[model samples]
Target: MPRFYIAQPLAIGQLVSLPEAVAHHIQVLRLAQGELVTLFNGEGGEYGATLSDIGKRHVSVEIKTHQPREVELPFGITLAQALPEASKMDWIIEKAIELGVSGVQPLAAQRCVVRLSAERAEKKMAHWQGIIASASEQSGRNRLAQLAPLQDYKQWITQQDMHRRIILTPRAEQSLADWARHQSPQAVTLVIGPEGGLSDAEENLAIQHGALPLAMGPRILRTETAGLSAVAVLSGLWGGM
Candidate 1:
C-alpha cells in the first residue's frame, strides 16, 4: 500500500480531502478509486484508508482503520550536523530520517564551505522538511523527525541540552564503537562537523560544555558519512535496528 504523510488531523470514519501535493502524486501514480492506502498524521500511528474520490485536481480518502505501529529508535538519537557543500546536506537529512534519528540540527561551523543567507535559509528549511516527510513515508516511520532551524555552531554548542552530546573527531583516543559497546541505550546528540571538521577551539569549547569526543574509526570519514555511520553502529550495538 502507498503510504502518505498527511499534515492534517486524521481519524477513522471521516472523509479527508488529500493535499494538493499528495493528490498530484496519486494522479501521477494513476491510482483508481477504492484502492487501499496508508495515511499517517505524525501524531503517533497510521490509518488505513481507501480512495473514495479522484477528481481532476483533487482526491479524497475514507479512513477505515488505525494501526498503532511505529518504527522509531529505542533511544532518541539527534544528528547535529554541520552544513556541507553542494546538496550533501539534503542527502544527509534524508538518510538520517531513514536511520531513525529523532531530530536533526543544522549547524554553521567553522570551515564549512557553504553558507546560507537569511532568505535562503528559510527556503532551505522548508525544502528539508519535505524530505523528512517523504523519507518517513518510505521508511515506514509513523512519526516525523524534528528539524531544527539552521544555527551557528558557537551558540548551539553552549546551550543546555537535555541529552548527552557526543562529537565525532579524529583527535579522540576511544572510538565510538568502543564507547557504545560498554554503554546501554540512551538519548544522545551526535555532532558531526563539516568538510574540514570542527576547529580546535570549537572542539575545546564543546568539551568544556560536556560534549564527549569520540572517534568514528582509524580512517577519516567525510561529514556526510560520519553521522550515518555512527547511527548504524549504535543501532547495531544498542538493538534499535
Candidate 2:
C-alpha cells in the first residue's frame, strides 16, 4: 500500500478530498478507486483508507481505521550540521530522518563552502522540508522530523540547550563511543562541521560553551558521513536505531 502524508485532521468515516499536490500524485500513480492506502497527519499515528472516489480533478478517501503507531528514538537527537557544498545536505537530512533524528539544524560556519542568500535559503528550506516528509513516509516514521532554520555556527553554539552536545572533530582525545558510554541524557545534540571541518578557534569556543569534543575514529569522515555515523552509533547504543 502507498502512504500519503495528509497533514490534516483525520477521523474514521470522514471522506476527505486529497490536496491538489497529493491528488496529482494519486493520478500520476494511477491508483484506482477502492485501492488501499495509508494516510498520516503528523499527529503521532496513521490511518488506513481506500480510494473511495477518483475524478478528473479530485481524489478522495474514506478513513477506515487509525493506527497509533510510533517509532521515535529513546532520546531526542538533533544534528547541528555546518552547511556543505551542493546537494550533500539533502542526503544528510534524508539519512538523518531514517536514523530517527528528532531534528536538524543547518549551520553556516567559517569553513562552509556554500553560502545561502535569504531568498535562496528560503527556497532551500522549503525543498529540504519536502525531503523530510518524503523520508518520513518511506522510513515508516509516525512523526515528521523537525528542520530548524539555518543559523550561524558561532551564534548557534551559544544557544544549544540539549543535555548532551558532542562536537565531531578528528583532533579530540575522546572518542564518540567513550562520550556516550559515560552519560545518560534525555536528549543529545551532534555538531558536525563543513568540508574543511571546524577551525581550531571554533573548536575551542564550542568546548567553552559546554560542548564535548569527540572523535569519530582513526579515519576522518567526510562532513556528510560524520553526523550520520555518530547518530547511528549513539542510536544503537541508546536504543534509537
Candidate 3:
C-alpha cells in the first residue's frame, strides 16, 4: 500500500482531500478510486484509507480505519552535524530518518566549507524539512523528525543539552560501539564535524562543555558517513536496530 504524510489531523471515518501536490501525484501515478492507501499526520499511528475520488487535479480519500502502530526507536537519537559541502546534508537527513533518528540539528562549525547566510539558511531549513516528511513516509514512520534551525557551533556548544552529547572524532580513545555497549539505551545528541573535521579548539571546547569524544574507528569516515555510521553503531549496540 502507498503511504503519505498528511500535515493535518487524520481520523477514522473522515473524508479528507489531499493537498495539491498529493493530488498531482495521484494523477501521475494513475491510482484509481477504491484503491487502498495509508496516511499519517505525524501526531501518532497511521490511518487506512481508500481513494474515494480521483480527478484531473483533485484527489480525496475516505479514512476507514486507524492503526495504533509505531516503528520509532525506544531511545531518541539526535544528529547534530556541522554543515558539509554541497548536498551531503540532504543525504544525511534522509538516512538519519530511515535509521530512526528523532531529530536533526545543523551546526555551522569552524572548518565547514558550506556557509549559508540568514536568507539561505531559512531556505535550507524549509528544504530539509520537506526531506524529513518524505523520508518519514518512505520509512514507515508515523512521526516526523524535529529539525532545529542552523546554529553556530561555538554558540550551540555552550548551550545546555538535556541529552548526553557525544562528539565523533578520530582522536577519541574509546570507540562508539565500545562505549555504547557498556551503557543503557538513552537519548543522545551526536556531534559530527564538517569535511575537514572539527578544529582542535572546537573539539577542546566541546570537551570542556560536557560533550564526550568517541572514535568511530581507526579509519576516519567522511563528514556524511561519520554521523550515519555512528547512528548505526549505536542502533546496533543499543538494541534499536
- TM per prediction: 0.99, 0.96, 0.99
Q: For residue 3, what is the lDDT in candidate 1?
A: 96
- Candidate 1 residues 1-241, lDDT tens each? 9999999999899999999999999999999999999999998999999999999999999999998999999999999999999999999999999999999999999999899999999999999999999999999999999999999999999999989999999999999999999998999999999999999999999999999999998899998999999999999999887
Clash count list over all predictions: 0, 0, 0
Which candidate, 1 or 2, would have the higher TM-score against the true structure? 1
In model 2, what is the error at residue 23, expressed in angstroms? 1.7
Instruction: Please list the C-alpha lDDT of all candidates, in the order they appear.
Output: 0.96, 0.91, 0.94
lDDT tens digits, residue span 8-91, model 2:
899999999999888899999999999999999888899999999999999999999999989999889999999999999999
Query: For model 1, where is the 10-residue window of minimal lDDT?
Result: 216-225
Q: Residue 5, candidate 3: how far off, in angstroms?
A: 0.4
Candidate 2: Cα lDDT at 125 = 97
Least well predicted 10-residue stretch by lDDT in candidate 2: 157-166
lDDT, model 1: 0.96
Better of 1 and 2 by lDDT: 1
Instruction: State model 2's lDDT.
Output: 0.91
